[model samples]
Target: MPGAVEESNRRLLRARDAMDRRFAEPLDVPTLARIAHVSEAHFIRTFRAAFGETPHRYLQRRRVERAMFLLRCTERSVTEICMDVGFSSLGTFSRVFRDVVGEPPSAHRRRGPLPPVPTCFAMAWARPATDRAVPEKRPERLRP
Candidate 1:
């Protein structure tokens, strides 16, 4: 059972690595499923179970991460950055950017270039909050 689990994880990692490397490409579940050597439905289910997000959501987050970096580090126009990050429509790109980063691309870019920190540190610091688990909501106390 452990070995089977390991093998399944390995397959998922291969597909995820491909997504990480080719984030700007038009990736779909079929291609990712082929990479994982699983049926599309299984791939989607297992991917969500293993990674805590759907493959499409993962890909969108990856793209938005890259766009966040580009927005902070480059002077490229928002439209160019949007297209370069694999989004077909500027409106969609802006919407997703806002959803992921909590702000539009131009607004994020207005913060100016990243400080002169190590690339690894910069990336880690600039990473969006989507990867973290959301805290459970608590009920409010009654007021007097």
Candidate 2:
């Protein structure tokens, strides 16, 4: 990558990191773009190029990941966990959970398990995932 593009990516990553930290609340593309000092289209494009997914999708996935952890590590109710992890709609939460984690939240809770894909393989397995298949937890080549 060229120097300018690398710098822009650094800015986008800054925005992404900020949103990740604050994902348990509302996040808008405009706000994220502003944080990155880029226009919305540019931000979205850069984000996808740099991270391989849309911002909204990434946020939802992160929320679901957090919810899975909390579900296994805590005794929180489904509804409580839904809102606590920033999912505004329980219906949507359940669907996304099933879509990405391969089970309904209740079933996952009952099973006393969470999404098994480790961060090492998070990129290959997260986001556009299945509701029934247990994703192979393969580690990706390490990055700096």
Candidate 3:
């Protein structure tokens, strides 16, 4: 309905694409703002207005999500998966994974087919037929 809004969304999508390319690099507000052709202040506000979270937090969550997938699907070590997902430190990755997935990565693995998690991530790992029904927006990047 809003044609002008399409341009802003395109800008946001461009910003999101750029973010995907340079995710491992430091993604500061000014950098993302420059990519979006918006002022840093406005970029922060606008991105959040459209996506529902701050830039940095979104990035961290994406990394964590990728790590979760790797943990579940691959035989890679936690440290390898941590670095593969752009986490530089084992301690930090473990803490963040625990925070988001709500359990230790090893414990989650040890749980076997039963899976290790609280209701949130467990709900995610569950294979409900309605999986296609959810609409997940790209999360913003993590802060330094």
Highest-scoring model, lDDT: 1
lDDT of 2 by residue, 1-144 (tens): 569978897898899898779989888889999999999989988787888777876777788878877777689898999999887889878987887787898887786643566754743543344233323324498999
Local distance difference test, each candidate: 0.88, 0.77, 0.70
Error of 3 at 142 (Å): 22
Quote the lDDT for 12 in model 1. 100
Question: Residue 48 lDDT in model 2?
Answer: 76
How high a TM-score does candidate 3 get? 0.68
Please identify which of the two predictions, 1 or 3, would achieve the higher TM-score against the true structure. 1
lDDT of 1 at 39: 100
lDDT of 1 at 30: 94
Q: What is the TM-score of each predicted model, taking all chains together?
A: 0.88, 0.76, 0.68
Candidate 1: tens digits of C-alpha lDDT, residues 31-129: 999999999999999998999888888888889999999998888898998889898999888887888788888889999998898989988998887
After superposition, the stretches of candidate 2 with alpha carbons farther than 4 Å from their true spots are 113-144
lDDT over C-alpha atoms for residue 69 of model 1 = 90
Top candidate (TM-score)? 1
User: What lDDT would candidate 1 get against the real structure?
Assistant: 0.88
Screening candidate 2 with a backbone cut-off below 3 angstroms (N, C-alpha, C), the clashing residue pairs are 102-131
